[model samples]
Target: MLAFVLLMAVVGIATPQQFWPSLSFVGNSLADIAPFLLLSIAIAAGVKATGADQLIGAAFRANAGKAVMVAALVGALSPFCSCGVVPLIAALLAAGVPLGPVMAFWLASPVIDPEMMLVTAGVLGVEFTVAKTLSAIVIGAVGGYATVAIQKAGGFSDPLRGIEVSTCGTSAITKPAKPHWKFWDDKDRMKDFVGEFRRTGWFLLKWLSIAFLLEGLMTNNLPMDNIGQTLAGLGLWSIPAAAFVGVPAYLNGYAAIPLADTLMQMGLSKGAALSFMVGGGITCIPAMVAVKAMTRLPVFLTYVAIALTGSVAVGLLYALWGGVIG
Candidate 1:
């Protein structure tokens, strides 16, 4: 299904004149994202091999609120890209971590990291950096709580798509089994490790291939300068507009800081700028692809909705009183 979908997307987007370059974009992107992909695969495989899910289950189930808060806070500070964060998410899900905290980490991890924050401070301002960091944490917390609330009413019963969750569910969290740190001693564990490594690696590469291909095509076709200017002129609508526009138009987080600065210099509203950064961080095509690859349809849709709405709310609030916080 993934292959057929990717093939269809390629055929639809890559015209004859653009086919080779689009392929090149996918190739280059794969190479560029290789470190994160390899690391993610290794982490997932290691967790499976060593039965570390036991530890993970214990950590998350202790106090749901604490787990969500810690996840949101760590996600903001840790420097993981959309692709780099997947293994942790998968591991958490497999360990039966509640969707709330998993979603918190998923939304926040790609938004702001220490390196990105410092670069943002340098490029934009210390004020902008601080505000964005707060935004990441706040958005994460809100999304997490919302998921928790909805799921309590029976919304996200099965949150996973590819990776299987714990059959023990809440029960596993209550009584986590002891893990075998030296998994190599067991032949079954060794085979599971190898199998997981290969499975996760291939899955990531394929999804990312399609994402990069779409990114390349979009990059070539979209009038980004015009889009930036449009964001500048939308006045009261600018915040929500930024939220929507940011999904497809956002550059990489590192690359985006300078661009955000440039857009602000060109009269982009502060609210719109903040909205674009936060919204884009959550819903950029690659991030969305990473998310979609892991979660079921209902969970994925809710994630997008919550992210965009939270970004818009944050942008509007910042516009009112960012100076006090920043």
Candidate 2:
């Protein structure tokens, strides 16, 4: 998409008004989202470096079902994005954790986390954030339970049956090892966190830049009236339509929310916009590829089904409630 946008600019196919807004919009969007993105990536790196992943994995090995439920809750509280959470989920699953709860954590982590909620509040207002968070919790719980039920009904067992738990022994011995003053000290930790921040901060900036350029081209070059007219009569179907449109695109909650807000103001239904955002988070190609890499085909399909169903349901529900509220 970024490449296509750039090509149009070079060929003089794009007007000056369109080209300039595209550039400025990209810059502005990146600037707006920089803080949340940095914070989220830093927290993820810090938690991993501090052995939280190992500790969490040990807990999962102790009681698979209960551990997954707890993981879902913890995922909701953590400030990681969909991409960031993938590594943690992969680490847990690789450590002999059950697939059911791992699926739940992956589904819920992006939409329910604190950073996403904060971004939602900033972009769509507090009401939207509350609604999104509540919806994510419900979806995550349902996904978790459904995964367990499917596993039981199918008499399925894990394929990675013999993998040893990575974190099992990390927390078993409670002796606190003194950190080397070179790397584990407070100053070093801060430097490490800042380094992580710069890395993820750059990543966020790159994507937001691309998104803004796309948004600008769409806004300035596309025929607004025609586009609006085509989408106007969608009504309830708009939510699902938006889901289809968003699923293939890769945008986290932070980047998607502001675009969603803009769409809503342009006569797009709130439910549809929200569905697009959620679906984008859950069903992007990168997310699916990551899941497939770690799990079998059945598990991967189940995960995709849960995300699609949950996104569509939430979108429709939001539309119904929003109608009443208005």
Give the candidate number with the greatest lDDT.
Answer: 1
Candidate lDDT values, in order: 0.82, 0.64
- How do the residues 46-96 of candidate 1 rate in per-residue lDDT, one tens digit apiece? 887888876676677677778888889989998678778877688788877
Candidate 2 lDDT tens digits, 97-173: 66667777888777757766777787788877777776667677788878888777874465332223454454434
Which residue pairs show backbone clashes in model 1?
none
Candidate 2 ranges with C-alpha deviation above 4 Å:
1-55, 159-229
RMSD to the hidden true structure, all candidates: 2.5, 6.6
Q: What's the lDDT of the predicted structure labeled candidate 2? A: 0.64
Question: What is model 1's C-alpha RMSD?
Answer: 2.5
Candidate 2 residue-pair clash tally: 0
Cα TM-score per model: 0.92, 0.65
